[model samples]
Target: MGPLRDFRPPRGILVASSITAAAVTYLAALGRLELLTTGNFASSQQVTAGADLQVANLRPAAEQQQQQHQQHQQQAHQQQQPSGIDTGLALSRLEFEKAGAYPQVTSQRAAAGIDDGVVAPQQQQQQQQRLVFEEKLQELASAADREDEVAHSRLLWERRWQQLWPGQAWGSEPKCQEWQASIRPRDFRSTWVEERLRGLPAQSGVEIGACQLRVSMPDNVQMRYVDKSADAEFLKSQCFAKDGAQRPDIVDDATRLALIEDESFDLLVAAHVLEHMQDVLGTLRHWLRVVKKGGLVFLALPDLCDFKYPFGDRLRLVATPAHFVEEFQDQNASRRNFEGHVLEQGVSVAGIDSLRAASGLPALNRTGNLEDLESITRNFVAMNADADRLTTKMTVPLNLAYSTMEHFGSYCEDHPHNVHFHLWTRNSMHGMLSAATELFRPLGLTFVVEELHTAGRTEYNMQELRVALRRTG
Candidate 1:
């Protein structure tokens, strides 16, 4: 105890000792006297100081942390909901309600851009609903536009179909109905022709030439048949021959016939006969001559463009005169002499001279006879030469020109007598008739076209063109 043995703690212990003393001082300031009254006051003071310090320093911080965590959870919950709801306004309203400040809270929320304080979520919900409504309206508008387009297309097709087959229902004829029932597709033009023919008025008197029985005259009409064959046996042999008992009224040739008087017939019907004539223009002129003024000439012929061959060379069958001559020359001549000269001219002249000499004719008589013979020979030679030149150089238009004689001969020899000489389209037929009118006007033959019917189908499917012409003058 001399100077109170100066008891200084170690540096590490000094820090601990200082902490204990400060803790005790803080506790004593709070007035806990029980610690000073105890015999083990130092130990008790250390323990109590630690407890008090922990409560004072860490409790407020922990509470503050818990409150902040709760706020974060509420914000997170609000964010998870739909975009329409607002958490800040709801929380403010709750706080103000607890504090009993209703009017103030509403005014504050309004200043901060909330409409009616509690109605913020409702406004957001309405905005979202409006956007959805606009999207639905756009979809409906697009659907309506598509429907309108389909309706317009349907109407257009209906109009076109009506125009094509006017006054007749599609596929409704007896023949077409049968075909539909059998599931077989026939050419529609055939049906169209049938309908048109059925619709025609009955004639008082009609003359039909080369009646093959494929088409018939109107019922109860006075009909006259003009056929090339008058022999019953020969007529019976034809495919469309009349019965052996019934005979034709007027049996005459189609090309050259003077049996009927001029303007004798009311309606001159020539079905599929104009194509067989060697001279179509001459035949037409003759027809016009025979028909009465203002009378109808119903002419039907196979359109060359409508015929199809498997080999596609059928079109070439409509040959020019030059083609016929060339072909005939190639087949008949030993040596191809297109100039209308004999292959061996010397032999032919010598044979003629020897024949004259062997006959013992007088010199003057022989000379006269030889001169006449030479003249005859020269005339024949000139005729042949002219024919050759015509055939070689001439080309008739497809619309006006018919089959060559050579083509017809070959066709008769090899196959059936059916041959198409020319090709014609609707426009071509119209143009040909118009040209004929001009060409024959100078000859006092006036022909006017009354009506024309062309099948509405492709060239191959189209069978014929029907033209009704009247001789006006």
Candidate 2:
């Protein structure tokens, strides 16, 4: 009965005595169960450091025998045994079975805050906190993946856009920098119109071709409307309409503005007007002449590649600074320019079949009117006869036929038509203006570029290229 000595008993008592010795040794390693004979509980360091280290290393192998031990304990607990059965051995084995559930040793399990099959309160709380942390980490990784996808898609779109429209990469040339009036380019929309007008030290201004009053004028300023063909009846019949029923104050050629005195107005406003003029530079000179010194000339014109809502001239090649200068040189460029516009309109807007029928050619008339369409399509065959001989296409094909330019020139002169005479973009327009200063300098016409703004796509793709100039001389 000593704690450390082996005792031999009778054959029936031998089994109980051996079982008791094994149970006591196992519990002692746990540093929990006390030995009554030893008078003290086993110390943790003593079990780990002593020669009984083999007992501490038996957990994995012991767990495999747990089921057999559990069955034996159940039978022992239910049935009554003889006095020599050693009840302490059965109870100790049951306690060891319950505590051995942890994957590691009993002492290590206690330090880690785990117990039996049920986790300790502290350990359960830590597991829940770990789960929450793992969930948050997964969410952050998912968000990062989504952001990466968006960034990659955006980069692809930008590259595709750059390939499609090369002209979009404008306003960055060394010379263009000289014309840069703003630290950052501003959107020159209708809303921007009023804000600029209010800031001007202007009282008198004339709005040429004020078809649609896109912006409200300042109450302090006196505004006058002047259109080339402002007959209300004529305007109503045209494809475009005016803002309201208000008529123009003066009806005259916007390019000439003959009635308007030199240096008479403080400001001249023209929206969708400058592109129609034949002599781009000369027209600008005339506009400058009409405005007083320190006067503002505000212009809003459409870009040639206005993909949104384009006109008949959308397909035409953008007129370059050199082309504009060439036009400025020709004294009678108006007649040819007008004829070009009529041909472009007849084919693009009025349709090739409509033009053929309007001209009494062997084709069905699709458009209702003949007289108006005829004027545009008249001499279409004669001007493009070479093209007809070259190509047998049924469509009324048109090309830049300089050999027949004289034929259409005479026709357009006698029978006038409304069309866009010039096609330009923001960059080309800036280049044209830059060229104009040098070309017109000898002509005693000098002006300073006050501002340049490019409006983003609005009203379904219609972009505006606006410019403000102050007449210096």
Candidate 3:
């Protein structure tokens, strides 16, 4: 072929060429593409040939070059494998793609008013500087994210302080000092089982909503997993149960436990289940009734202040013992209680009501009825929108208010079983249990907190509060 002049590459070839160029910078970061000292890649002859170069032709040249390189240095033979090739730079294909998306060197050269295909030394330097700037920007962004996480944690800690001691300013009390010092984060699971339950003459026990048994029972104990239904199909149909979740041994109401005889079991376990109960006192009484005297009732629940539940429980104050007492007195669901939960959790009221109506159940309206769907939908939309705008409650905008309303709506609609009726802290749980013991004393059933494991921290960053109550009646 005569000396090619003004030869323009095919579109496919140009795209492949740009990809190859980008790949060099990309692989260089991984220390895959080594620098060729000969500088033949950008030479005048190669530049002329670049216009008509095919991918097939390019691969052979690269292979030949690598073979020659291996022959020249046997020491680098092992390190120069195509699979493990490293270019000794920290660039990614995406970075290259984003920097110019396909930084065509020929186009760049022409833009800089260069007739020759080779880039000027000054232009090369500028390109290197740009890459360095991008890397530095990434590092700065990562550091800022870390700082934001720490600041948010501190803010939540401050909010927790306010919830515990309402109207009391942060860092202004001796109680706060004492509380901060007393936080010794730990996992209390083994402590309760080893100390309280191991040596006991416990024979049989039942666990409510036992997807996977939380605690390890003694070898002699026969533990039965319990849920609303024993049928696999029914369990799968429920919103909470994941695929292959443990099937329940007994089908019964969680609050009543009508099938389980009074004072029949030696032990009772309910992990992450109590919060779903509408009447906390009634549930406790039922739980106490099932377990024989001196038998332990193990309870584990999420802490209200935990960072894990930022959507709802973390935002609202812990439900007081008095509030629970009222719930116990009135077994029916109240509008105020439902409304507060919906707003705090960013859940949809229409979703809840729709499900309730579909199931032939009465509306959760002791006060707030579903007279107007538009108004209720508006309330849901408005609350979440305001939260996203104002609060640090959401680190990433999940669009739960508008776009993702369907998701939260479906959550309420599909799974009408339970939501967190009450959020608890260590102190709040203790107070409630203490009040429950006295209030239910007339029924000839009582229990005392045997061991409380509200540890400072656990593997989950924060441990849920677990309490072992021993039946005394």
Candidate 4:
């Protein structure tokens, strides 16, 4: 039994099995596998019959008949005239062709096309406007398709871009997505980001995102360049864009995900987003592991908490005694309890300032001086004082019974059929950064350097601090 000989199937049985497998594969290829075992073909026959009776059965059948009659009339006219040339057909064909060939309108595209950077009066103004509208529709379509924040952010960018340029057009056309997500690098102020290039001590190379750089000469081009650009248009944009702001290696989460599992980017940019994360520490640890020694991570989060919530139907809103709303504080678990809301998943956003300081990221990486905590808090207060915006004004009127003035945090949780998991404030953000400096001090992953950035509605708060952080081993 230990070394038993294997038995083979009979010739006839083998042939039958092969035939069945082949038939199954063939039917599957034709997308008719269900027809093999079930009366699916018969069901299709019923649908086919209904389609045939489209001219006879439904109310639309009358319209179909009229269309057939019109087609017959058109054929009759074509038959009556011996010429193949049809001016009407030519115009219709041209329009259909134009629909696909025409580039879509985005702010930059529109700006590029317009005279004096404004919509020019043209007979095709209507067509251009339609293109702009389609661009908006396309963005919404993209948003609907994506479940994660990455694509959502793109739509946010699209909305903001559209607002900036009303009749803008997109040079690139986005089609139905193929993957779960793609990587996007945060915008770099200067292409020349200083980095200690791996393998070369004290050597720094300017890094550029895939969007801003192109590689040429196939034999000499790099794999990174290949992933960045494949077509001439992409190559041109990445290569020829103005301002020689030293291109740097810019990679997004999805791209980095392909490179490393359970890892975060060396250069992380949090733009009003860190507050959304339930566990800031867990996320921080993940990024710290993969980032090269001396590489930078950046953070920029909203200081306000009026727009966050939990994740379920039972998620209820709680009232807090304060001017601030108790939106899900990724730092605080229970809306009512400051401690329960502390961590979402395994990450904690507490003590960011101490974490950075403990790790070694001092603002004085350039200035060569350590930032004291008192100075940090004063800076945080100053930043908040300059960056804060009051959004207590509701755009839509709410009944007094439903409205909770100071307890507006419930608004985010109650509306949209779910509650957020965290609420962040300028105090919390600076506090978390400040806190992480102490909390992360024991964890061995500390920030060596930091750059601060704050950005929001230009009308509300123009004070945007973009922080780039270097990790000290």
What's the residue-level lDDT of 360 in candidate 1? 31
Candidate RMSDs in Å, in order, are 48.8, 37.6, 24.9, 27.5
Alpha-carbon TM-score of each model against the true structure: 0.36, 0.47, 0.49, 0.28
Give the CA lDDT, 0 to 100, for residue 99 in model 1: 35
lDDT of 3 by residue, 162-215 (tens): 111111111111111123334445755545565655665648888777653345
Q: Which 10-residue window of candidate 2 scores lowest in summed lDDT?
A: 1-10
**Superposition TM-score, candidate 1 onto the true structure:** 0.36
What is the Cα-based lDDT of residue 467 in candidate 4? 53
Ranking the candidates on TM-score from highest down gives 3, 2, 1, 4
Better of 3 and 4 by TM-score: 3
- Locate the minimum summed-lDDT window of 10 residues in model 3: 1-10
Select the stronger candidate by lDDT from 1 and 4: 1
Considering every candidate listed, which one attains the maximal TM-score? 3
- After TM-score superposition, what is the CA distance of residue 131 in candidate 1 from its true location, in Å? 83
Candidate 2 residue-wise lDDT at 23 = 34
Ranking by lDDT: 3, 2, 1, 4
| Candidate number with the higher lDDT (1 or 3) | 3
The CA root-mean-square deviation of candidate 2, after full C-alpha superposition on the true structure, stands at 37.6
Cα shift from native, residue 324, model 4 (Å): 17
Model 1 agreement with the true structure over 1-473: per-residue lDDT tens digits: 00000000001111110112322332343223242222112232342343344334434644465346457756987755411112222222233223332210112233336443345665654443333333322332332234332222211112212111110111111111111122123344324334534545654444444433424444534567776666766554432233442356877766655687778776677666664444456567777878778766877654433322111111122323332233323443212222111101111121222222222321112223221324333433332233212211111111111112122123222212122333344445666677678767887889789776544323222245667898998
